[model samples]
Target: MPNAANESSEGTGFQPGDGVVEEASELQEASSADRTPEEEFLAQMLAASGATNLKEAGLYDPAEVAAEEERIEEEMSPEERQAKAEHDALAAAFSMIRERSNEGKLTTPGTWAAAGIVPDHLIPVDFSDLAFDEIIAAQAASAAAKKVAEEAAQAVVADADADAVSADSSVEDVAASDSKADEAADENAPSVDEGDSLDSEIETPEWKLDDIKVLEGKQTYLYSSDYMTDTYAHWAFLAEEGDDALTLVDNAREESRLYPRPMLAASLSSKPYYWNAEQIEQAWQAVQESGSYPDINTCEASNGERYFYSTDYLSDAQAKALAEWYSVERYMNV
Candidate 1:
């Protein structure tokens, strides 16, 4: 008896024989020596998907399905058709964006401690969009880093007690050690514990951070280049990704500019690379002065907290209002 299913699959670029992969592949290829691009694409895809027989696979005819879709569109009202078109466009746009985003990834050194978690390819690094994932990841990373820092500090303290090492740490002299200990304690970073003693052997399995701080308002940069030996990396630059990298700072600034919000200094203080108060102030100045972030502007709240906003995103009055709401008013109620 002749099979109708086999006959139907003849022109669909999929073959139905004994439902064997090897047989199907041969039959499908032989069916069309001069196949169109669409046919080739469909045939290759169907084969890859392990579609042996169209009848069992429940395959639909592309031409018929497309024609039906066209007919449905023709039946739709103008507004309904417009809405469908918009929805499809949005869906396609999202698909393309996600696809493009997967092409590249960001990474960081283990020495970065908790901050290392941000560029681990968990989220996209593009700054054109203000994604909540990035902000959440940053906050989580900061917290994790701070906790690890405290643990590492305590470990050093224990090691020192065990070894009977004096306060005059080999990393520096007695005076310098005391000065650094005071500086670490005085550092207004969000609960960063550098320990009572300034220890340089702050290595752990999770982190091998000798030092991430900038002394004399100039810290060592993560990336060293031949032209410049400056200790500071621009808040907007990602060392691994080159100048093309758009930082969390840039993302925050863009969010502020586009969304009419404020980026708080206290929020950014968690990053060890720019944790120093004087270094942060100087770096922020240099970043703005570089002319890349011309839209970025700084304003101080009544409580003496600093924040940045974009002129492109908000007027001075609007920026001040929001900064106050978050930095002051929000806290007052809490």
Candidate 2:
């Protein structure tokens, strides 16, 4: 007989290393060949998913995956990162869709179409169930409300016009009454008498100096410079003569620097008594003869008031005459 093992192998058609192991080896080789295409398809899917690398898709070892993830993150442009973020958001939304679909809360497009509830983008929305009758009722109510408001406004305007007419009538009546009252008052007023008028008898108050008296034993009068030297002194002497003749003399003396002639002239002339022409002439002559007559320029009266004139032309006799004329007392106390 041939070798028993060889006889059995020949019966089974088995050769050395040509059994199931060889077949398995061949299958592994074919799988290896298919693996390249499968890997390429997976890479394309991952690219479409916006995964940066196999590591992001959980296809690499932990250490290698970490390195790959870092490399992918580093290598990605800003735009790529943005795109990846959008893809992630879309994936999350899809995941939510899937979860809701699984939970029966959301229906698929096929289901929606079968139920006659297609998306508005794909089909015109049907509003058959809408309550159009209620909308019509609301519109009618709005129109009725607007009409009521207009009617109310018209009523208010009519009322306001009536009130304005009444007010205007009242105002006209008031004005007429006031006019009548003014006319009545004018008719009832008393007439004034021309002869007995207050203006005829009322004497104007004169600004005469008071409490003026000659100091004894002093030929020349003395007075406070500041008190009598201003424009008011001239005004006082020019005012109407009064009982205050001495006061007028004092004022003039003070204003004219104690010039005796000007002081007396101002005092006598300011007296209110009506002197005759002869008396006036006599008074004037006395003033001319006064020894203390002020110089011409300083002696001239200004604003109708006598002031001490300043001049070199005044003679001694004229000065003496002026002083004597002014010295006569116009009023004497008994």
Candidate 3:
């Protein structure tokens, strides 16, 4: 006739006799009946810790959480629960595989073992069988493309050298022609008047320049002899000191053994030489008519803008080869 529940609690590993059973029963009842969200959260955290207090369990022990998960799986429906377990296992295996690959490690069975992700019979077949051939084929194609580009670049260099020689020849021819003309002019000059002194000046030849439209804030100047001679050399010489179009093109021929590409009309309006729209057009027209550099040519891009290149430095075929190589190289780098 002692308290029957107290006797039961005493028979268990708990302390006896002091109304412990009733106190524990009441606490359980209160938790089940009206637990607040904060209390429920603490209960879960404590369960994950597998200890009476958080400090005793060292915060949240992963081993305890894993045990709790196993306990949860035991309560779920067999079919749904087994499927979910397999999915989680596969996800973990794949995550290890991806991490190995990201670390620049080879994807082999050894790598999977190192990551502690052994291949399971229930998972799919070997990944190498699925993807290795395709990857190798792609790499081969890339290598071939790079080889082609390198060959094209070599061809461009050869063409540039040949064009430079041709440009030099053209310059020599111009110099010789000028020398001959000077000799002929001296021979044809009328005899000076007997009354004239030896140091008397000769009258300059009369020449005229055509008027050109210019930007409002700028002025254009032309030498009369430039119009009369209508030569690329004369035009280049007559071009203003700061004028870049003619000088830029000429210097490219002399220094680099390369030609400046055709320029956009709008592109010339700004920068080191601010050529007006009309001026650029006129200058290009004069270049075409000068018949000086036979190798000088123009080509258009897909954007419908024309660019100039000197054949005197590189032939058309050589230029095309170099261009294709560069285009491929750029694409690969990208």
Which residue runs of candidate 3 sit more than 4 Å off their true CA positions? Answer: 1-239, 242-245, 251-270, 320-333
lDDT of every predicted structure (CA atoms): 0.48, 0.38, 0.43
State how far residue 304 of model 1 sits from its true place (Å): 0.5
lDDT tens digits, residue span 76-178, model 2: 6665554444334323333433343333233222332354433232331221111123223444555555565566456555554444444434777767655
Per TM-score, the best of the predicted structures is 1
lDDT accuracy of residue 225 in candidate 1: 26
- Candidate 3 structure quality by residue, lDDT tens digits, 1-334: 1222232334334222222334323333456447676556655655675655544434443455565455555655655454454445444544443453333222343344455443343333343232223234444555555565566456555554444444434778757655555554444343465214312332211111121111111222222221223233232333434444454356334422623233334555544246686776676676677766565555544444444556667666655554444434456677
The residue-by-residue lDDT of candidate 1 on 134-199, one tens digit each, is 233444555565676787667655554443434665656766666655555445333423343323
TM-score, per-candidate, Cα-based: 0.28, 0.15, 0.23
Q: Which of the two candidates, 1 or 3, achieves a greater lDDT against the reference?
A: 1
TM-score of 1: 0.28
Would you give me the overall lDDT of model 3? 0.43
Clashes of 3: 5
Please tell me which model should have the higher TM-score, number 1 or number 2. Answer: 1
- Which numbered prediction scores highest in lDDT against the true structure? 1
Q: How many residue pairs clash in each candidate?
A: 2, 24, 5
Taking every candidate in turn, the Cα RMSD to the unseen true structure, in Å, is 24.2, 52.1, 38.8
